[model samples]
Target: MTKKAYSKLLATATTTAIVASAFAPAASADSKDFSDVSTRYADAVSFLADKGAEGFPDGTFGTHLSIKRVDAAVLIAKVLELDTENAPASGFKDVPARAVGAVNALKEAEIAYGKNSSTFDPDSHVTRGEIALWIERAFQLEGSVEVPFEDVNNRYKDAISMMVANDITQGLTETEFGVSALAKRGDFAIFLHKAYQAMVEQSDFLLTVMHTNDTHGNIQDIAKRATAIEHVRSENPEALLLDAGDVFSGTLYFNEFLGQADLEFMNYLGYDAMTFGNHEFDLGASADGHKALADFIKGAEFPFVSANVDFTKDSTFDGLQNFEVSEDPADGEIYNGIVKEVDGEKVGIFGLTTEETPFISSTGEVQFQDYIERATEMVDKFENQGINKIIALTHLGYDDSLQYDNDLELAKQVDGIDVIVGGHSHTTLDEPVLNEDGEEPTVLVQTGEYGKALGTLDVTFDENGVLTGYAGELIKVSDLEADPVVADMLKPYTEQIEAIKTQSIGKEAAVVLDGVRENVRTKETNLGNLITDGMLAKAKTINPDTVIALQNGGGIRESIDKGDITMGEILTVMPFGNSLGIMELTGAEIIEALEHSVSAAPTASGAFLQVSGLNFTYDSSKPAGERVQTVKVQDGSDLVDIDENASYFVATNTFTAKGGDNYDVFKKAYEDGRLSEPGYVDFEMFAEYLKGLEKIEPTVENRIVDLNAAE
Candidate 1:
């Protein structure tokens, strides 16, 4: 889907919190005035400022100067929260008068002794190793990692080991801690900031919001995420759990059981509300083809809010109905918002799905309203109903340039919206991005694709419901222990899925078959080549005249690790259940369709194509409709130009032939009845094609050239 790249572990979480409470609010990149410091230390200086810590006496931060022993006492006294009022009598005789407040406080708090038992080296220059030692003592930190530093004094070696194990510091070099080097003003800021952040990570909070999006059948990680959610509920009884949709595709759990597996966990997780994503309609469009979506709707234990969905026009969403959470939910409250009384606070949560679903998914006879228009209407209605805090749960992507409207645009355009938890773009915000540029400050959070992360946001408000402060972070679902109850529930379901997934299909080359989410959606890959080849061969059986086949890059989910291939790997790579389609198109129409395919080039657009029986060249720097510079059809062993009026038969997925990914040219041809869907399923034939070969080694041969390649 989008960038879900994870970063470093947050501050060591020093406090004794629940084992499941591992959500560390990401360090904000807030800058501060430190004229002598490098920007690398800005985050540290900013954090120190947030804690009301001061700089040098000259009004400049003096980040380049070496820290002295008294300076360490004052900073550590503040970070460790030692009482300063009425300083206790210190056992040290060398303590200076100006530094007495800090030194006595530390000694009274039982965190510091002295250079010896009777003397405090208040004026001595602090060393890196000494600073590490003092920090460990202040935090009462335990656990140690072997350090290879040669210059560390034996007195502070254990302390250095403990700090390193806690991620407080890494050696200056792989083998050197620079133990005797003087600690700089910048270094002290970083050390104190990290300690302060860890101390306050879970102190307390008023309200909390936990959300997920584009889970895509990643049930395993959801097992651990459920534990995190449960811990959040226990911590704050006022917390609300939300999902922004697209819980449908990407694994055998979905393929074999539709959405039953994911829905079961969603229920177990107890989501308060959720919205629909385009992929939710991947299968449901025909009169009776909506069985999967209908079943998911029926299984939902939470409200499904879609202000723009006009299901009355179709029988596909037969049993679904709008929820009423208030006696007077405003004039058009269902369109405006769903009301929830969370800890005596009236919360308004509204839902909005992208209008592009009909073009990218199956909606059958259902119609979608303009997202921006509906969002404005709903926000006004919620406000009229006296709800000041509003949450918009949308399937609209977070700034998708290809779409007419995105989450950022919605936040800026709609007034009174406080928070936006969204999907469809699959963007991961490790920390909530605050958009204060809007009429009312709007906070946005999304936890990319798959069930890899669970996002938690703690928001504080005054009695009047006006948001005052917030802290947020994405907790990685990987590596955490799954809940016992959830794991037991998943055992039987997983066993059945494993039976077919682990079946040996064939062997792949010793190198990885790269179909990574972002790469496939943006460019060509060997896995894409293998997939397109299979589609061409399968379609050729029914229509030997099929000259070329195309596969949408978005349909490829993950990379196949090098080794013996399994049926499960193939399914993971091509999770969508799509059938093959044969169609006749004029050469001009084919070119027009290709133009639409590359319109969102260089940005991981799902419309990007993988093809067989043709080689084309394009320059994305050119205008959208003019990117395709060359087109050639394969003939025997040579390629030749395609005649503009010539009618050529092509093979592709049923989704693409029916206007998925904005392929209007294909949609027009399908409506003209020139397109016929063949009964062969795409992934089944793909598995057979891989097994047919002794070892698969499809290469990228510039079949779809980008003329604007870097020199």
Candidate 2:
């Protein structure tokens, strides 16, 4: 604005600030819900209102309204506390008088740059990443913020992270920061207030780290996540975004597109850095070894930082390098970690993935090292280079507890690390836990799997470079509005998924198959019975003696709501492509396996077995290995038991047959040649069996009972 207009605006803001300041302390921190905007952005809008930023003349915060570059520049000028007395300099060809000074101030300050030396897109819409660049530059951010945002354009990745590390912005979901989306005016006000506070606080600075883990190809809700992230970044450019890997598997999105849809969305979100999760290696031992991972890496627009995996031996990682500030992400994806500047503070970043990946997914020829050892080594490297603030982007499960892996274990074992963004174990650490149990205070945080939740961790370090204080929260992405642009981007891919998903497996369920992960894992449900029965049917086809079948709770990811069950819904519930195996187990081994199933009773475990052609009663209050109070086999409506030495045939999935979920007996049976492969794809078998019975109802008819009385 011109000098005169600037003075008038300042006077009005000062008066409003004074009036609002009186009640600001009394205003509860909870966001005031706005009907027009997505509930997810309520906090950003409410924060601005609390900070004395007036709404539109109509007395509403236009959250979904597009923000203009000129108006955005005014907010930036106000928050940076830039000088307004300078006369308007109308140098741009399309420059207007009111915005000339604001634009000039930002350009001179080197915070906002011109589209060219002669032009600034002052009237254009402000994008999430573009705003981050201006704000990061405005504050002279010298440290970095890194994330697994789907769309970290090479041009603005650094700026995006710079904003994150300074607590200037956040994300919609843990893995998305909405780089391609436009900002709103109400959010612009919130951004300025946060910047103003950060600018005013000189002795210490705050950085908000937004993180996510294990999305596993659930990109359908990414657009909604984009809206929430853009709203946050629009307000706080100095926020750090991160992902703990596993963005590569589970649904049709990955199976059909081969990570293309996921990669595009990540680029649109503008992540700074990401680590490798086990599922990233889910392409398995391929004929062309590292080709799948290579393709994923080659398409990445952000740095792929992983300190543990040795990709050097593989030609797929030929372009991998430890990135430097001078490198461009578009040239090729960088690997490992490096130092970055955020708000003039030097911060070092390192990446690590779980050593257990080979056991769970297919890493092929890739090798993994001890997380503690690699983390310590990386920390020493960063410290030796003089970067005190260290963040470890890791795929170690939140509390994996393996001596060689897990974020909690790393926190206690490593010394120099400040924060760990973690995944695996599908843990939901809604709050950042301070592991003062170690020599150095390490704060560890993780989000639950899927794009279901977003985590924000606010950390502050003193001038001495010691992490002093912190706060955090996990945001649910369900409340946000899906961005139109992101929705458009997913249209074609989504159409492909729906086409398959909607096809009738030519069957319907008379009773609801309760496939809820929590319930299925803890006890026997009708759906589990039906699934196991299907396996038994398939096993019978191979050998009539194969009478029993078992399905592990873990392999079942979702539940088919009561209705005509489509192949799509079945796949959604059982997304993993697991095959069936028919194996022999003695009566004694059967009892032992039943004991193992309930070993983690009281607390749900995916290893819990859902059985068919048999019934048993278990007391959850009993100790592990002793939970089965009774067991019996069904033989034409008759129950039989008492033959401990008799060998019986049973069917199960390849994951459990080969010892996944720690099925030691089954793995040992496989090793002994007692486990025979029937070669049945579990989901297809279920679909085939469903086709046999046009309308079937699975009944929970005391097949297996949970004896714990609800007192």
Candidate 3:
């Protein structure tokens, strides 16, 4: 039989078996009556009946009935005892206005999230994998296990793994876990029973970890995550809400509010602890961004922790604590961790961040230490303080790169760290990754970026407060309802920022590209051409000698798509508040900069230069300084050989003028008074120039040529 047909047949047979078993003794004299009752639950009647769950009184269990999204939520809430007192106010638009209470209850308990906006599709069908995730969240298992399904990757793996580890419907069979299969009511009932039993077993220290990452200024998802965490809190008093960071910066809302709205929303959500992400410093290397961070800390109900950063030098943040050690009566002092009394047992928490923060972060004043070294030190400190259970809240990315190591390495290197709540790389761990470096297992997990998933690690410790085992799952935000208060708090900022972003700046006749992989620095995109072209246009008006303009590839942050482009979009593309400046250089100095550009071809190097009104060529096979052997000027007639004796006015941004991109040639230009004062031209003026053009198109016209072939 086909798989579909086989599944249907199995479902029917299972229901029949359950119904027959329920009435076998009493219906011995009435076999026909027993057969009549067997049609509803099919394979699931026994399990549902055993758990005191009854179907509609029509003598039918409705095993084949497709489970509505709302029903699935209600089932989880009912089974986990998620109710009104624990759930926050509902903000979802589609959730039945009256059913808001039930939805809020489930949200507060950390059982359901709306995904985006305050709109839950209550009528949607519930998938088998989804139900498993809910069950895992409700039960709170610990330890990282591989996901059973082959199709599940970093995205939904965390949820699937959690469900599998908790004994929730084992992915269709013992070996094959299909993440997309529809959940039959009978199967769902069985999973719920198993989860309920597990919860009952752990009635002592009911620990709930409600976590969200890569929030990116998405206030609506924050509300949903908060509601779900609250739902977990209702079941257990010792619940804690944690964020893996990158909460502020990214979207228009973040740029507009400058992290204020995010702070307010996070405050409303009641986050317990959070770490820093690279994007947190997008504003610039200034005290204003730090002030914003300080403001957030002041408003936060929980602590902001980062072990690698030495904030002692920054006097503005003197009040912020570097590390927190909480002691449990049974576990003693827990360093780099938080100890909470959950069901009377002590739970510990710690925090870490990526070592590449120094390179990626725009906050130049901030510094980062070695992640593994700092983590080891913190672990030693905490262990010395007598803390047995430890969890690391890490912002390190999931995959290891040459610049920085992933969290798996950290878990292996650190002996005492038990669990790691990870972010930065946006990896979704369905099951915890096993630490290859140590004997003890280190649970590593990350909810996907943009608050799309919630990660819950349900851990159980022995009587001595030493961690014994754990289970974890990632809950998708798409299935639950959003909380209203958080949404309301963000409404004004969202509307304002969106309006600003949508305001049209110009029209495009064709697609304007930006960066290309492998040659992002050397490549000439339509957007790059437009930006350099604008700089040239703006500079020639000031200095008639301006024969060419050069813009660093790194300075061109975004591409302008072919459509109604806007001033706001331009601002987003070039959010760094840099201004245009003019510099004078000889042909030899220009060649030096061009040589630097090709030195790092096929890899990202800040020194890659995009030029306007000049054509040059370089050979990657040649040495750095000798690569650019030919330089010519585009004089509207043909390529004329550059005049080494004559001075050329080069227009560039303030960043490039400061010898950025290894263009030390500009340093001589600056010292010679050739570097003019900052001009009126900025990204905004460029956008207006595009708007005036009505329709501008950019093409690669061999601006750079290789002289090696000519020779």
Best by lDDT: 1
Candidate 3 lDDT, 1-711, residue by residue in tens: 122322322222223222212111222122122233353334344444532345544454555565766766754554443444446686788876445666787777677777666777887777766776676666676535776566676756787776666665456666667657777665676676565555555443324576777677656566677666767767555666788888766455665676777777676666677877766654546646477766666666666667776565666567565455654311111124565545545555666767666554555566678888888877776667665667788787665342465777787777777778888755567765545467666667788666777787665455554444555578777677777766676678767876887776547547756654334465655666777888788777656678888878777666666767776667766765455666777877777777887776645666777788888877766876667757898777677888877777788885677566667777656544466532333564576577677557778777855454435
Taking all chains together, each candidate's TM-score versus the true structure is 0.54, 0.55, 0.50
Off-target runs (Cα >4 Å) in candidate 2 are 1-199, 321-331, 502-566, 572-609, 612-628, 632-711
Per residue, candidate 1 scores C-alpha lDDT tens digits across 1-711 of 011211101112222211110011222222455455568788877665554445544456657778778767876765454556576778788876656777898888666668787898877888887787777777655568888888776888888887677676787888898888899877878877665554344222245799999887768666688788877778676689989988876566777788899888888888878888877877764455777887787767777778877776666565465533342333211233588787666888889888867754667777788888988888778778887788899998775533345788888888778889988666778998877767677888898767788889866554566665666889887757888999888888889988978877656656689898888887778888888888888777656788898989988888888888888787788776565677789999989987887888877888989888888888889899999999999887899997779999898887788788989998888666576543355677787688788767778877787788632
lDDT of 2 by residue, 1-711 (tens): 123333333333222332222111233233453345456566565655543334443444566677878767765665544564473453666656556766778777777767786788778899877777777777665557566777787788887776677677776567788877887665665565565555545435556677778787789889988886787677568677778888876666876787888889888888777788877776656676657677877777777777778876666777675533222334236555766567778777788887766654567667888777778888877777777899998887665434336677788888989998888656667677778778888888888777788788767777878876667778788888889999999899999988977877667777678998898998878889889988888778666888788999998888877778888888877877576666789988888888899889868899999999888888888888878888898777788872679889888886787688988988788666565542345666788788898578888877778788432
- After TM-score superposition, what is the CA distance of residue 21 in candidate 2 from its true location, in Å? 8.5
- Ranking of candidates on lDDT, top first: 1, 2, 3
| Candidate RMSDs in order | 17.9, 18.9, 18.6
Off by over 4 Å in 1: 1-205, 316-319, 323-336, 502-530, 533-566, 572-711
> Over the full model, what C-alpha lDDT does candidate 2 score relative to the true structure?
0.72
